[model samples]
Target: MEPMRRTVWGMLAALFLATAVTVTGCSVTTEDPSYIPPAPLPPLEQLEKAPLADPKNFSSGGDVLSFITADRTISCSLTSARGEHVNLPYEQNGYSDAANNKLPIVPVAHCGLVTYQPPQPGDVKDDCAGTHLGYLGGVALLAPDTARYGECRSGVTPMEAAYGPGGTKAGPLTQLTVLADGQNLERNGLRCSAYNGGVACGNVSAGVGFFISPERYELVPAPAISSASPQAEGPKTP
Candidate 1:
């Protein structure tokens, strides 16, 4: 009887030990309380396409005038004076609903260049490089002549290239004035400003700025197409 009792006790101990190990294994495999997944980044596929603007959108002086914003976030499309379709990509933010108390849609136009300041203080020249379009002295201008556009150290997304490390910030421009001679204009509820060298227009609320050089890019007040006169009745004979 004593041997039988000893054997039974040994078996009970083994079962208890196995049960404890099983519970311990489950505790170790439980999910972590403090683990958090990182936020996903934006996929900038638009950067892969060829750049849209060349020398301030209106480099060639023409009868029809139109301007294109370099901002990547705002969609810009209009028929050129030559009847060519022009479109630029843009990003929109915020909400329009008043009940939600959300902010209105603020559109920030993304330029196509990376602007860098000089390493030393008081350097007259800035190392503006990254893309064809660059910001200099509070103005965004063409930089391929002054600096190589694709030589920047950063990756070439419109946002990363324009405002990445060592890049310069855009100028503070408020109010929009119409560039047409003596006539002010508004488009899509935004104002515009016209100057001798270029027409500058920006919406502070939307965080957008558009600059067209030589004032010829103005699209409004375009020349009307004349009606075709009726063909002579005698021309239809075979």
Candidate 2:
């Protein structure tokens, strides 16, 4: 009976020991060798607005004339001869003014040498009636409002000489100067003036010249100075 009891206790102890070992072996723990968390993104900010200029006081100088073909969609800035900063984005009705009523956007007529006819001194006023402005051989000619015979002379010879063989190309112009009432000014060897309701330009010596007005724009042949053919000369005093 004692031997049997001892054998039973020994069997129970061995079973418990085996059970403990199996439980310990079955349980497992593992750590990842290459796992990492993602980094956070940077914060965003709102953009600032551009500063604006005063519309009422924006009419700064330099003949602030707009071209007849000026594109309103294209924004730009220009300085006038008066040294004023005129912003084009703010301009309305072609004129960059508060009232926007001063300057008129009239179509400009660009005429070449072949199409132009030199006006006889006596018929200048009548011939240039509907004309606005004209250019020949790279020289800018103005139509006369009145036939001032002696005043109508070729301003091209001097201009062609000053600005090279073909005269200065008009492609580089950005702004046209508004001649003060009856004012005449010289620039780049050419003199421009407003006369008898017509705007005109010529060689300093009054040799070759052109005239035009707001209502008229034609590239008439610049009047010849002398009855004889024009001499290839530099600017002379008008």
**Candidate 2 lDDT over residue span 5-124, tens digit each:** 999999999999889989888665687778775542110000011122232232324432222111111111222211121233223223345554444332121111211234433344
- The lDDT for every candidate, in the order shown, is 0.30, 0.32
- For residues 1-238, could you state the per-residue lDDT of candidate 1 as single tens digits? 9999999999999999889989887554778899997542111111112133322333223211233223221111221111111112221212222443433322222122233221222222434453523323222221111111122233343333334464343321111111232122233323333333333333323333344332222112213457999877775666
RMSD of each: 20.2, 30.4
Show model 2 residue runs off by greater than 4 Å: 1-178, 214-238
* TM-score of candidate 1 versus the correct structure, residues matched by position: 0.20
Error of 1 at 212 (Å): 8.0
Winner by lDDT: 2
Clashes of each: 12, 29
